[model samples]
Target: MKFASLDPASVSPRRSRRLWPWLLLSPLLLIAIAATLAVQSRPLVEPVDGGLKPEEIQSTKDFLRRNDPRRLQASPHRLLRIEERQLNLMLMQLAQRYGQGRGAAQIQLQAGTARLQASLQMPALGVWLNLEARLSQTLALPQVEELRLGHLPLPAWLAEAALRRGLGHLALSVQAQRAGELVESLRFNPQELLLGYHWQADSLDHVLGAFWTPDEQERAQAYNRRLVEISAAYPPGSSVSLALLMPPIFELARARSERPDADPVAENRAALLTLALFSTGQRWSKLLPSARAWPQPLPRMVTLAGRDDFPQHFLVSAVLALEGSGPLADAIGVYKEVADSRGGSGFSFNDIAADRAGTRFGLLAKDAPRSLQALMRVGLHELDFMPGVADLPEFLSAEAFQQRYGGIDAPAYRQMMAEIEARIAALPLLQQANVPRL
Candidate 1:
């Protein structure tokens, strides 16, 4: 009989931080745990029945084929489609690779419960931990209330405590809700977990394009209010990268905009614009050299009363980082230093945040030509290629540069950005490249 080994005491603090999030995010892991714990004291019978249906076999195969990134090898068949004896053997092989000893595990669907049976190995205790868990479909989180280790039953208090702790760590409300919905849609038989998720073709565009819903409308406004409160939290010379992921409210706004029958409120529409700007700016920042200079995006708690805005302030302070003795670095550094010197006030950057606050629906971006040129110099350092000064004469013309890459009004702008990002991704790291041009 195969046994899965688990030694919780060996988990280090650093590993715990990384592993807990991954484990807690996946409901499948929870089910696997429940299935492992529940198989205790259950009779081990030969495979009498329980194999995935033909259609389920096809869908599972298709899911793996699409999701697996490895192109050089042929995709393997789903485990649930195979015989129990073969499945356990495969699990044993996987267990060895993952530092877990082989474990005998099986799932069966009966009387509206997805039951999992397993003989787990507790290496620390040197004991066989047998478990049987019954997973029932409920509106809230699925409970693995019934659990046993060997002939002894696990305390309900212990299981509930663990469940509460696991769920508490998932802070993304929107993602958690989606995960719950995914669990709810699962159809399980002893053989397999049937995913009834209908893939939406437009979902990616709807998210990236800044969609919003009524609830999201409120959230977007809240985001701006938060921005107003926290914009001054850092000092005049300190600046941070706008690294925050697009919030759910923006996605809702995009959906609202696409619907012919629905009209989005002014607040959400404004939020959508701000988020889109923020997302685009953050993306463009990556096309340049120094990525770590972009700190983790400020949290919603600080910016939005839990409602957050896309940052509009060009990071004048960060441009100072480009200064160094190297010819390319010094050129950019001197440009930014000179520009900041000309501004007189320590706060040389424009305060466009307030423009977003009241009824006015707009923001003023600080115009720092020297800072822009400095950043381009950094980008050039990353390339082995130098577009000869004669090949791109507009590189010297300020008006030409602005006309070519300044406006973000047209859909073609997005295509251009995509191309720029692709080109950036193809280049080597700045430090790795030996080009001597500034």
Candidate 2:
């Protein structure tokens, strides 16, 4: 029952050998610790000077600054005046050929000088052109209607001549009108149109000859060709024809005629830069898929009061909205009511219904799949997605409208909704809420 006392000398050799192993391992552990300390103590490299030097950085900045769209300003006044002169010349000849009594019918020429004043400050050249075109359209209606109706019974050759002259006049008139509106809407004013007329003799000559000289024609044609090229380059719903036409016309008119700093190449380059920037800004939402997923809520719902003539009228109240507010909400309500009143026919919310609340829907509603295909085609070819329900509300025919709006054929709504969902899934977590749930 007595406790046994153990002596250090009697310990087993195996146990003593284990202690030796620990002693031996101490140096290795110390070495590992030393290595870690050495590693941690080492100085971190300054991120290998990846950035440019101050001077180089500044030089690049300077290059970008020099090439900025804002720096490429041309006198909108001069451009407008030139446009006006060209338009007047074309109109006079049209009146001579197509007026009711040959040149006897009074030819009235009015330019939207006020509108042109506003165009001077437009940030984008394309918008300016649209404004000009709108102005011209308003002005040419009277002359165009006169020629079209009056010249109907003339001989074929003479009729053709009249038609061409009338068309030219109408084109110029519309272009000028649109330009003026665009300038006014954007609130741009360059005050360049107020200068002394260096091209006074040229203006007189243009008025005398209904057509541009070959040289002038070539310049205008080249500009138009560029516009065609640009329009073709963008995807469906991404280009505006009027926008493409403005910059070059401005540059060409300024270059061809005597003007200060008559550098055509520089002017052209500048015009191109301005156009690109403006177009990018305007179509940025359409061009970038990421942009579409962001939902902007409208402040309030819109309601349009019923009108006797326009039972189905609607308008775009906001360019991009999360919730409708002000006029936009009212517009949306009007559009929805129009759509709902049709009772499933192919007519859009903008189309007039035979009955105020009829049950007759269009072909598109009958065959959604077919309608979607037609709508896609319309989106691709006609409106280019830039047009809302308000613009070009009618299609090729009522049938076409039925097919486009109500058909809903290819890429079925469900499929499109799914795709949109997938796209939303891929977005950053914060942006997911913006995607509309179908």
Candidate 3:
């Protein structure tokens, strides 16, 4: 320590020499910092108006998490769990990417409406462009009102004048226009945004028909009429013909299989049985009056007595016939029981069992090829008393039903039956029963 001369003069020159580069770079560093802040603040939507309660925020978050339309299986009207800040940040990033320069927007929840304010930052010129608007919708027609740009009001008169001059038509999309037309009303509450639509019996048919050419529409109408006739051929308000019911089940199965988000096998099984009950308009709860079909626990493995009279004896028998004894099976039993109680009934358990040799479903269950038997069983299940379960277009009217599933004679119906028959012939039935049926 004594050997080294600690002279201030000597150290000061060395320190100053080392600091020169940083001192020279200080202006660029300050500029960078200023630029970053300016970029972040440009067209910023600050959380200034705090009206939402803690509970409201929590509930809204929960609702959004539970119900996102992006989730295919989710309900149509759902809240998004995303926070306003994050959403604004995303919008800003998107705007920046698109050369809009830090376009930040924010939402403020108010009574029956939301206020949105956004800004665009011109970092080069150190200037900010601001926009303010309120969201107010009529029916499903969402309109952005009170739109202002840089303190200048965007008047309704301007829009009306533009429309009058044919400068631009309302700036509303075709989809928005159609939604406004279709939706009867719209509601926004603390809970969620709800759009109410009135669906007439033939509304869907008419909507679908709109997509078809005149010749195609005529053909579809004729085909649909024929299918309705076939569906209506079932005995009025009694037993469902599983043979006739097979076509819809087949269509449902195909559709279910196409859904990537679903368990197709399980859905197909449940849908088949549910549709069968719908076809006959029968409820499952009453099928077994002595047994508590619903509001009771189902066994993990429901052991069916090795009796051919089984499935025929119970509308849910078809579901019970599935290969596995798991949650799906248990759900089927419970749903079937509930469905029987909720829907229109045609036959008692005993009546269906005894008529095994007489009715089409009974005969199919009794003596048809094992594949067909399994198909019938797998396709049929009890319906649950849930919204939108039995709203099959065909079931709305005999005419509609006939137009969709026109029995064994209709080409689609015939094709489905033939395909199921071929599948049964090709594949062996899964062995589900532990005991042999008598």
lDDT of the candidates, in the order given: 0.36, 0.31, 0.40
- Local distance difference test, candidate 1: 0.36
- For model 1, state the Cα shift of residue 257 in Å: 47
Which scores greater on lDDT, model 2 or model 3? Answer: 3
lDDT of 2: 0.31
Residue-level lDDT of model 1, residues 165-192, one tens digit each, is 5345432344444434433244444554
User: What TM-score fits each model?
Assistant: 0.26, 0.16, 0.25
* For model 3, the run of ten residues with the poorest summed lDDT: 383-392
What is the Cα-based lDDT of residue 190 in candidate 1? 55
Best by TM-score: 1
Model 3 C-alpha lDDT per residue in residues 1-438, reported as the tens digit of each score:
369877867778779899899998999998776554434334545321322222333444455566433443533333233445544444443333233224456666544676666666666777676666777756554566666655456675454343344222322343244434556654444434455554444343334333334433333233233334544554443344343445454454455445565344444444434443433334322232222233321111111232222323333434433322122222233223223333433112222221221222222233332333335444343210001111112112334324565522468645643443332232222223122222
* Stretches > 4 Å off in candidate 2: 1-213, 259-438
Sort order, TM-score high to low: 1, 3, 2
The best-first sequence of candidates by lDDT reads 3, 1, 2
Counted clashes in each candidate structure: 32, 55, 27
Candidate 3 displacement at residue 298 in angstroms:
49
